[model samples]
Target: MATVSMSVNGKLVSRDIDPRTLLVDFLREHLRLTGTHVGCDTTQCGCCTVHVDGKAMKSCTLLAIGLEGAQITTIEGLAKGQELHPMQAAFREHHGLQCGFCTPGMIMAAVDMVNRKGNHLDDQTIREELEGNICRCTGYHNIVKAIHSGAEAMGAAK
Candidate 1:
């Protein structure tokens, strides 16, 4: 086991974990942050996405030890107090999800995309960037709408 120290959801956390434990498992099983989901065994599914030092990352692709000294943000940390993050609210208002299994990671990825690209995201650009994620339902129409609406809401708030 390796002792790793990192910040999670704005809280400092240090724990002992097997070096092989994936960051997703560490967050869910250890920290009880179950919002992060794993929809595919392979990393192709964006369902396991998280923010590492403000950048989007597939949590399943990185080992817990590999995240040492990094600041990680999961879906649970995206809001402040009782307020919903614009992305989350937009998804809710736009009906962006179906089964909802992929919502958390999708929102995280969308937020990361907008944070990096802003409201100027074109449909093709959004589709290209979101290729890493797969949604079995909604045919991606609502997803794209949600991203755009979320971007608009975020822009308006700023």
Candidate 2:
């Protein structure tokens, strides 16, 4: 077993885990942060997306041991008590979700996109950035709209 320490959702946490434990499992099974879903164990699906050091990354592609002191943020971390993050709010307003299975990861990835690409995201840019994340329910029209609006809100917030 390997001891891992990191800051998750602004809290410092440590755990003794197997060396091969995926970051998604560590967040879900170990820390009980089940907001990060596991749709495809492989990286094809972005359901396990999370923010590692302020960047969007597939938790399934990373090992908990490798993230040592990284700062991790899941969907649960995006809000302040009852106040939703701008991206999350936008998704809800735009009806970007249907089954809700992929909402958390979609929100996480959207926030990261805004962070990296600035807040004024065009539809084309949003679509391109969301290539990794997939939504089986919504046809991505609403998702794109949400991301575009969310990006603006995020920029305004900043």
Candidate 3:
């Protein structure tokens, strides 16, 4: 086992974890942050997406021990008490989710997309950017709308 330390959702966490443990497991199993889902352990689904040092990354693709001292943000970190983050609020308002299995990761990925692409994302750009995240229920129409609105909201906040 190897000792790993990192800042998760603004909280400092340290644990003795197996060297082979994936970051998604570390968050869900160790920290009890189940918001980060694991749709595909192979990193194709993007359900294990999280913010690593403010950048979106697939948690299942990263090793827990390789992320010592990293600043991570799960979907649980996006809200402030009862208030939701802009991306989350947009997802809710736009009805972007159906079964909700991919909502958490989609919201997290949207936030990162807005951060990079700014608020002026066109529909085509939104679709292209979200190719990595797969949502089987929604057909991605509402998801695109949500990202556009969320990106605008984030820009307004800034």
Compute the lDDT of residue 142 as modeled in candidate 3.
Answer: 95
Sorting all predicted structures by lDDT, with the top scorer first, yields 2, 3, 1
Give the TM-score (vs. native) of candidate 2. 0.98
Worst 10 residues of 3 by lDDT: 111-120
Q: What is the per-residue lDDT of model 3 for residues 1-158, given as tens digits with 9 covering 90 to 100? A: 98999999999999999999999999999999998999978988889999999999999999999999999999999999999998899999999999999888898889998888888899999889888899999999999999999999989987
lDDT of 2 by residue, 111-155 (tens): 999888998889999999999998898999999999999999998
As for candidate 2, its clashing pairs are: none
lDDT of 1 by residue, 1-158 (tens): 88999999989999999998999999999999999998895998889999999999999999999887999999999898899999999899989999998899889999999999987788888888899888999889899989988988999989
Which residue runs of candidate 3 sit more than 4 Å off their true CA positions?
Answer: none
Error of 3 at 93 (Å): 0.3
Per-model C-alpha RMSD: 0.9, 0.7, 0.6
* Candidate 2: worst-modelled 10 consecutive residues by lDDT: 36-45
